[model samples]
Target: MSRPLDKAGWQAMADTLTARLETRAYIDDRFVDAAGGETFETINPATGEVLARVASCDQADAELAVAHARRAFDGGEWSRLAPTRRKRVLLRLAELMEAHRDELALLDTLDMGKPITSALGDMAGAIGAMRHQAESIDKLYGEVAPTGEEALALVLREPIGVVASIVPWNFPMMMTAWKIAPALAAGNSVILKPSEKSPLSALRLAALAQEAGLPRGVLQVLPGFGHTVGKALALSMDVDCLAFTGSTAVGKQLMQYAGQSNLKRVYLECGGKSPNLVFADCRNLAQVAHHAAEAIFHNQGEVCIAGSRLLVENSVREAFIEHLLAAAESMQPGDPLDPSSFMGAIVDATQHRRILDFIRQGQEEGGRLRAGGEALDGPGLFIQPTVFDGVTEDMTIGREEIFGPVLSVFGFDSEEQAIALANDSVYGLAAGVWSQDVDRIMRVSRRLQSGQVFVNNWAGGDQSVPFGGVKQSGNGRDKSHHSLAEYTELKSVWIALN
Candidate 1:
């Protein structure tokens, strides 16, 4: 109900957040650059303008970072530290993150083009994840095997050695914490590779980690192109494991490298074409439609588990879609730092152009553009939230992951048809069901092929919830206590005492 942010509000948001923006790269526990002293522009996506020049790491930079990590891990300065002591450092890092929340939040908005409110939410969420991991670290006890008579046996967790984690730009700081929290808790040293599109927050995170007393090399960052830095990490024998969050194509490529290279463990949370099933029932169609619109339109539909595929029962398809189209028209794009802006610019020009091409493809495939079909004329790379009605399962728009604020609508006559359409995609990251019937909710959820399901509303998640997907969406899990194992290795021992 509030009006969009005026010019003064936007300026205030920018002024508050950029005070902590240091135009240096955080590398190997220091805010410095490669030996060649190269730097790259960190752009403000809201305007397609440069915000600052950041350190650009290359292959040599990666080698230095890995060597530093190897020494830190071998010396056991951090890995060998007592769990309680490690907890203190992690807790302190969380505190630091909280203190610098506003700055980091603004940095993400400036660099990634997400709204400032969403950026701040990411900071708060990252700090919460760290605190949760710190609490969980000490609670986890190595197993005591139930031994036969006259036998002693024990099992314990060990750090998985050096990890090279690649994160996407959509949720920079939050995913970084998702990787580092459990990895550090289990005593593994880490080397991070943040997307070149949004590397500022990750660099700031490195500085904060060091200030919190994390040993040098224990947490280092590499910010470079995926073709170079990403492939290096994937193929490095020195790197023990790789955790990545990005497109399914990239995940497959990394898996191939993992298989070819040291057979290092690979964990990924890849793309999704999640389904939002709306069944005809005695409920509020308007409310359900609003929730569905928000699911796919939030963050300009950059979320991996975005409910972009909408399957509505034939009986309610017309009414539901009417409400959906109305909602989509209201999601306007503007400056990210605007306090009242619901929609922000796309992350970069390339992605913006890609989404536009997809929109053209939808029209060619006979899908009707009900609302929001094109990019507006603007200075920043901004795409209005798009919708394609009468979409078929075989259309390219339905099959491919657009990673934008685009939705595909499908009408189904039965529950079986809806489920079939939902499961047809190669992805299975998340799904949502909207029905007032408890029986319908229980039935559809049990058969839905997704890691997370929302019954009546799209549930905003929390740290305690285990989230990840089946199939090409990725392997392993994040968030809950189970994620701890992904960053750890277990060892079993047996001794006979007479």
Candidate 2:
């Protein structure tokens, strides 16, 4: 069913919306200035307008946040809080988020220029994930090993020290909650560094967290650039673990920083050039095509798991391509504030131009554009949902992640060839299978070298499933019980009896 775009609902959002949010870097549950008196422009890509003058947090602000987090974790006020108490605090935070969701989501759209619809989903997903963690917080436990004769071995699940969670611009609020909820539930104090492009929600959340009765410094948000606050979090000796979601290049730098600084646990959810494989055995090619368009078109294809590369069998290639183009043509890139808008603006002008550069390069490299290949003329940074046919494997558009509403189509003759083509990319983040045959689903899921594989649908996760990729896609899991372990340490206790 289509979501209702009612006038009342639209009017409510319009009245609440603002181009800028009043916030500051959160330290010890209080808003403060960056020691460095610097600032940056947070722009609205939907209209290329400056939304807010955000603090340019430098090394000093980073140090302050880390110190506060270290104090909170080491003080044991938060880390030693009983699981039920932690759960109560989490539940309270969830309620607060719901209460202010419209405000938070609207501020996010204004700053990042994501559609209000997308922002609402971000807010809902963040609240849902927090509730999920609240319910499961009590399930945490340590395991007792079986004894042969002498004694028993107890494996205690203990909270690690201060944690640094760095989120990307896309889905900032949801990603922030994804890391914080599990890490906090596992009994660790956290320092959050949201992307400067969209840090308003993170700061706003920090205030709500304080109101939720979370002890001072239990959760801190540092609104700053990657070179300063982000780098400090990654390189701080006091930070026991670091979590990040961004490009592979930054992920690699985090890996190196972890090794160089404290050898801290680095959890990363990086980029992708995932395959959405369409076998000839599929009956509904049109439905499959429409869903594929949705996969890339959603969030302007800023999703880490966008099915960017479409692998179609040669037999039904032409018909599927026709349907895919039709789906793209139907999409409208209107104002992000409008509730009726589907495709929204790119997150920022840099990203807008980056996606456009890739499109132009795709054309120059002989890839055929069946749909869109240019940015629409207007005040907003809007690009039409794009599709390229006859894309060679070597082309930059096919191999590298464009991270926009762009899809590369390559036809395959046999099952072996399809698998080979899908696995050819350096990234193994996510993939989808569209086939009626169960055997094909089983075969492809096993052979596909991705962290998550979606069969007959686009969704591929629950809160329990580990959500990290292999190879260049970055390491460590985000969701599931496994994710909680990333922010914890296991201490071995042995008794000496003589």
Steric overlap count per candidate: 0, 1
Expressed as tens digits, the lDDT of each residue in 1-498 for candidate 1 is: 446455576578677656657655556678776656777877877777787777777777777777888899999999999989999999999999998887777778888899877777888889999999988888888988998888889898888999988999999999999988988887889999899899888888888898899998899888877887788788888889899999999999999999888999999999999999998993888888888888988899999988899999988889888998888877777777776777888898889889999999999999999888778786888888888899998899998999999999999999889899989988999999888888888988999888889888785689998889998899878887888878888899998978
Clash list (residue pairs), candidate 1: none
Off by over 4 Å in 1: 1-10, 13-20
Model 2: residues with Cα > 4 Å off, grouped in runs: 1-20, 496-498
Q: What are the root-mean-square deviations of the candidates from the true structure over C-alphas?
A: 2.4, 2.1
Query: Each model's TM-score?
Result: 0.96, 0.96
Model 1 is weakest, by summed lDDT over 10 consecutive residues, at 1-10
lDDT of all predictions: 0.86, 0.85
Q: For candidate 2, report its TM-score.
A: 0.96
TM-score of candidate 1 versus the correct structure, residues matched by position:
0.96
